[model samples]
Target: MAVAAAFTLPLVVPARAAAPAQAAEVAAKPGSPSPAFKTVGLRTQLNWMQAMPDTMPLAQMSIPGTHETMAFYGTAFAEAQEFKESPQKSLTMQLDAGIRALDIRVHPQGGVDGDRLHIWHGAADQKAELGSGVLGPLRDWLGKHPSETVLMNLSVEGTVDPSYCPGQDTASCMSGYFKEYVGPGKQYASLFWAPSVQGSSRAETPTLDKARGKVVLNVYRNSAGNPYSGWGLNYGTDAGYKAQVQDEYKVGTPSAITTKWNQVQAFLATTRTKRAGNLPYYNFLSGTGIPFLTPSDVAGGGSTGSGDPTDPPTYFTGVNERALGFLRTDSGERTGVMMMDYPGYGLIDEIIRHNPTSRAGTAVEQNGQLNAFVRASDGNLVRSYLPYDAQGTQGPWVQETVGATLKAPKMAGNPVATVRNDKTVDVFYRSDEGHLIEAWRPPGGTWQYADFSTSGYAPATIAGDPAVVNHNGVIRVFSRNPANNHLMESVLPTQGSTAGRWEKWDHADVTGAPQIFSSATAVVRQDKTVDVIYRTADNRVNHSYLAPGSSWKQELIPTEPPKGEGKLGEVAGDLSVVAQGSTISVFSRDAATNHLTESLLTGGVWVHTDVTAETNAPELSGSPVAALRSDNTLDVYYRSKDGHLIEAWLNSGSGTWQQFDFSNPVYHYAPPQIAGDPAIAIRPGKVSVFTQSGTGSHLTESWLTTSTWTNWDMTADNRAPVLG
Candidate 1:
């Protein structure tokens, strides 16, 4: 979020004691050997924010102006409210406290003849309390710490003497004064970090190695003649500053401050996700408000007099506390430059914790392997995967729920899984909050949850299960945007600085929920194109897909039946689509008759085909799932109405349908039972089907290899399984 480069009169009364003695121990004068200057063991262990040049304090180091010299003092103006925002410490102390940015507001102290520069806050002179001469100490500090950099933002805050530059104008006079103050033979000659400034529209972040022990000056308002005038860096304009002043006066309640903090958090999250990495992002965490005080109360001696001693502390304290909480929940994402008020009492440390480097090596590694993700009876996402022992022998399939305490009772349908380009497995599910939640395990890394709500594109409007497919390293997600019941697609970044950014597309306009069992399915074709199929709101099957360099186009799957077959009836449950070679087919169950229906995309048009014609096609009790075999043949699995498992396949050469009964009453300890939707996965030479028992108390698995069928109970009391 951009902060207006202007100052307003406000006081942050110190309601708490000073920070611990350790904070003061590192506070040493320039050129002194301080413990804070010591380099840590590793660069990764350091706070990334501290390494960036843009991190800074909100105001320049200044001493409080006394009531006698203060312009607004007396006459109902409380002296306690005058200089509370000014820093009591020197520049040396601020530098040691890990503050790399400095806000220096310079104005002409004497008349046109006077060459001295004095720092002022509004009408009050701060030269006495803060240092009178600022450049000397700042120059000395750079000489001592050659590895640290500081960003000095110089601006003209108050009125400047018109006679300083005669007809040259205020901009020229300010520019001339800055140059003479820090130019060659001046107070800071050969001290400023001039190379840090860029002349291009995009200013690159200076590397630490090049900017070590340097002072980067940013003049907010420079003359046209100045080489650094159009640095292209964003600076607060007069109009923006005026707007901010008006906003400050309008917000008078603590709740307004809370609302502003929420805006800041949202802005921070967006910046973290979309930042270009060329320049640092900054946020001013302070808000202007009088939550505890009103004009009537302040008029009745409530601020200065002890009549209203029971009033709460100033609004600044509340903002600071909220900022601290935001930083904690930010979870180590880079929070650019955070210009803050009262940046003491261990607040710098809290801000530094947001540096990404501080979180290096924190991601749990999952190692290379595919895992099955399913929702357990307890409403927790569970993972079931095969483990290998020391001798390379496969161990029993282990089942464990992820983040056991986190519940997903509102999860719709089954979680979908896909393998990323790096061979890591990602599982996507709808959370109870109607947001897309992803749990992924990187190769050699443990499982990690990528909550889309925080990672950028959060469509809380999602109404049903999401379908995910990874094509050529890009993970694409398709979900129904409940707002319009239109399908929405989001593509994950494949690589580079924008790697984690989720680029969302316009709604694909496929029918979404109100039908609880309806969901979309997607598959990647051989040419890296994507084919998606779903049940429309009219209970008709529709196909939408995207080819390379093309937009998504939709077409009806021709489910109207072949002339005399009558209507196929409504789609009962979720649709499944699979691609084999150049052929793409969709499978669904008829709502009215429970008859499994199939559609083949031939020559860009869908051709409805019946899987069972001569033989009796068992009525389906659940959605049908399809998988392509190694020989380019299709295998379909579904639960039968009699609570038995059935499979259908097509003859590779003749394109004829055949059925196989996997439920054997003699082999089972009890009568064979099946429930819910079945998931299919193809291995090297076999096809595996995972389903839940009729009682929904056990997870069963059936596989077909060669001509033999094997069945076993995988686990108990697990939801419908999703194979990766």
Candidate 2:
């Protein structure tokens, strides 16, 4: 007759009614984090642990046409509903890997109670052995006592005969075979399993099984013990065993090794054929009349074979992949998607990996149409093709059209800049004829495009970074009008009778053309106020602000006073502004003395201070970038004259800039483009900076958190699409 089994066993009462209080406690504790579980004092533990050869680790047990192996080492818990419920209980062992051969034993509060349980070679075959190799007479007693939780475990064992190699020289990573039995020459064996359950598990093993398997778990190897050797043991519940050793592992003589090797040597002497990383081990846990069975699942496909559990360190740990563009935003659903997509389709799921942040907005691709396919800061595929003919309407994100023919622009190309509000987003780019065009999203619809192209306005060429912001429920767009040397601001209403239409244009009270005079930067503060920093034609940094609904308030902040009134040549100033409460702090790199100065707004009064001495008193020339941390601390990332990324932070609530060198700066990359326009964003504990790399257009992003600084060079210079 053919026999079958279930996934888990039935909970049975061995004697009296099982207590409910203990079960309730166990259920409650499951919700909270606990230490790793450990099993001890099982009468069977001492005997079964002793019965198994110390040198040979049971790793893989196989059936016909299939081989199942343990993926990692899980905690062995001694479970009981209550202390008085059943003293004669046994624990069951379940494996994440496939089950093949099982070694079972019974420990009667005193008498011998164990069974080999049932054995099978395939799905259809079963062999029940009750007398030899496992179960004794007490096996029947174990079956009658259902309340006893069995301490069941599987010991996967393998056979490693030197003949398998036959004098081969080349061995695979994590797997080494003896070419020929030499004198006292040493051989390496590998035992891999999970060290902890919470983190990703990795391991390495060898096999003649042809198919390479996934890295094994709980990597264990025997070595000549050294006192300084790093020996890590991870066990217990999730909150349980946590041990760390730094630079503890060092090479030493065989005699200096620990006793674990001696125990391994003794086991090897008697059980040379049964080495670690071989055959699988299975244990019998009490179950319904039908037991829960685990079949053989190999790491790699093919004949389930095993390898040396003792391998070198290089084969186990290293950088595997890179994470990028972690952004947060509101989603139509709860737990909105946190995207990490790049221009190269190198998108990875980062949803909820870290706690969500309220300050950042979700990133989405503008749309699959035109150049709109770029990924947003938030990480969603923003299809901006939605129809937003009416204001207050937003569109849905649709999938890209497969094999669809893409059309070029109707006339000339239009250069545009886009920004998103709470729910709506708008873009305004220069069209073919130098006229500005607008596209925006309404309340609940897609983006609608409009050409606000006008006739000849002026002969002046507009040149400067355009600024966009959502203030007081009104969307505003500003750009420099080089003709009249003025800052032009346009209002796009979010809740208007004609939602997608713009109200009218207003002129800001600040202006300067780079080619004609000095440099300037305009930024909108969090308080719905506008602040602009510029270098006057006299070579000094100056600051000005646009009040809620008033004119600009200009303040002069000088590094080195000009000898005369007007200065020659274009004086460039690298300026950045961030708002803290109602005040705005503007930092600028002065052109004359190559120093940094700051201007602050306190209770409507502007205070100018020379902050260069606090920033390491270093020479500066290029543009500086800044981002606000959760602590409300402003971290400034900048490029030195030598073209390396440097950092400075306002240590105290007061605006005192303290220079702090970045840990992992691009020290060796030649011709570093740190001087280029630097961009920064602060989210949670992480701050990311995007800058050009070594005079190349490829953007290299470096991230800094409390722990470490990581960098990833965007895409290679090759424009070809990455082939899968």
Candidate 3:
């Protein structure tokens, strides 16, 4: 298809013998190394020729008005390690496999005057005899083949120039001659085109495709446009010349590269793809807390509260554990919570009280049922049986065997769940698709999991944050639905089977819109009726009752006093409802300030009270857990804004609030669940509270005994534990 030269370089070629005789003694000396080819005195000129297979037919192709050599050297000779060791002795030659010779006459001055380099391939030594100024033959040869390689030597014929000399003896003049050779096809052919007189520098392409690994052409330029030429070889063809320049040398990445040069530059861009992986990274701030723990610790501690002296408010102490999970029981047995500690990472060093001999289950996502507790076990705590269920039941929790371990789908973030118990224990969790799911350990049987909503009903929109409640014998799951601007709930059988049906109730009809509503908070009252309390968008506490079998009844827990108490009342988002007898009490931080507000259902109506007024108002979040104290009063615990757990309670059934200085302030106090609800039997009287600690390590619990708060402790199981 195309006409070009084929150059198969000789393994060891001898230079022209006659021209080197004058410097033969110098050449005979130990050849230090062949001098690297330079571009100072080199020049290039292209020519055309008829295609030929071998050197049996060659034509003389020399530039007109130029006596300089275009010494073509392959990358092999130029980059050979041996070239470095012996630059003076190494022979630099290009193959002439496809050049043919032509019979020509030689003049004394040795001038073959022509219009252009001849491009006619006939024999390796083909030449035409002509006097110094015959240009017609050269033009005829050029017309024949317009594309071919034509190299020549640079030097005067008979003697060296003297008058315009740059100061050189005979040695320099004698070493000026070089041989010319045409190249092969696109792959095995390349040239060292130098545009200079001193042979000091030049650009080169590899002789073979394999020799050139990945070529990246970066054309550096000033105001004159691209300064680098001969960059087309990087793209394997001339089609990429302009593209290669625009990509590497241009200011911005243009939408399209229009020229062959640019395409070549784009081809070269592959070379820069891997440089990003070679940079350094900072190692200091990446690990656990190396900086200050909190602002107060860094700024020299200052008092945060000005409550009373006998019962001063304190900040939360940090409580965290790892490799521990929370578990509950069917008899509602102390809502049995268990966890395991690896013991290596500050396990025994902290106030962790669980035995070291426990077998932990896997840490799975949305797998709140990984609950293994130290029940009334016949064996040691280490041998405590973990309850799982193959079928739904009300007692003796059994493991659900599945093809693979239960895990949250890949894209979900920190999938978690909490278990609540009535007749049977059920785990309520938010699925990866943002729908509530209930997996139950049926009484005396295996576990069964089901989606909370039916397909034909209203679509369920579950919030990532969810809470569950076991009321009387019914298990209720609560979640926020942003679609309809309301909190939603689904209920299940609380006494026997694990299967449950979800019933959706609009908060608007339940709480009445225009009156803002808070997120969902449900409590299984002592009377077995469900009391769901929440804050309206207007920051008022609203209550909805699912009384026995009756329809949902909604009412606003009035915070406005009987027109006498000069203080104003407000309700916050984290609403909590607890029923003690007919007096259902709702707790939440006041909207006006970070203070706790209590609404008591008295005389078939709700009444409001501020427990923080007697003591100083402490910051609180989430719903506070309430437990009937040994004194028959209500003790409430919650987290404050300063990141500490605090407690305040009614001293008596008469509604007189009193603050107590329990134990050290805990760092983070999640919504806590009281173990001794009036419905359960083995009532410890002592309030056990479960919450995630500030360290974010594991769940921790604190117990109140004999009117005093005790140190926090993690369970024996290693999975992260949570309270429902």
Candidate that would win on TM-score: 1
For candidate 2, the 10 contiguous residues with the lowest summed lDDT are 1-10
Which stretches in model 3 have alpha-carbon errors above 4 Å?
Answer: 1-404, 408-422, 453-458, 467-472, 493-501, 507-517, 524-528, 548-550, 563-568, 621-623, 629-631, 653-655, 661-682, 705-709, 715-724
The TM-score of candidate 2 is 0.38
Candidate 3 C-alpha lDDT tens digits along 1-724: 0000010011111111110101111211111111111111111111111111111011111111111111112231111111212211111111011111111111121323221122111111112222112123233333342333332221122233353225755333222211111122222113323221122222332221111111111121111232222221222232342332222212111111122223322332332222122111100000011122221111111122465897664432111111111100000001001111001111111111110111111111112222332211111111112344676432332323220223311111012223344334444444435555554554456555565544412236454334456454455555556455466655556344545545555556655632323345565554456666666655566677777778677876554446312232544334555556555666776543546766666557445556676566555533354544434556576654433456776655444676643324352223221111111001234454444333322334444567564544343344323211
Q: lDDT of candidate 2?
A: 0.31
Task: Kindly report the root-mean-square deviation of model 3 from the true structure over all alpha carbons.
Answer: 35.1
Residue range 685-716, candidate 1, lDDT tens digits? 66556665543235666656886667776664
Listed in order, each prediction's TM-score against the native is 0.46, 0.38, 0.40
Cα lDDT tens digits, model 2, 638-675, are 65554455677766544356774442344422223332
- In model 1, which range of ten residues has the least summed lDDT? 1-10
Instruction: List where candidate 1 sits over 4 angstroms from the true fold.
Output: 1-370, 405-412, 454-456, 495-499, 509-517, 560-569, 667-671, 716-724
Which TM-score value belongs to model 3? 0.40
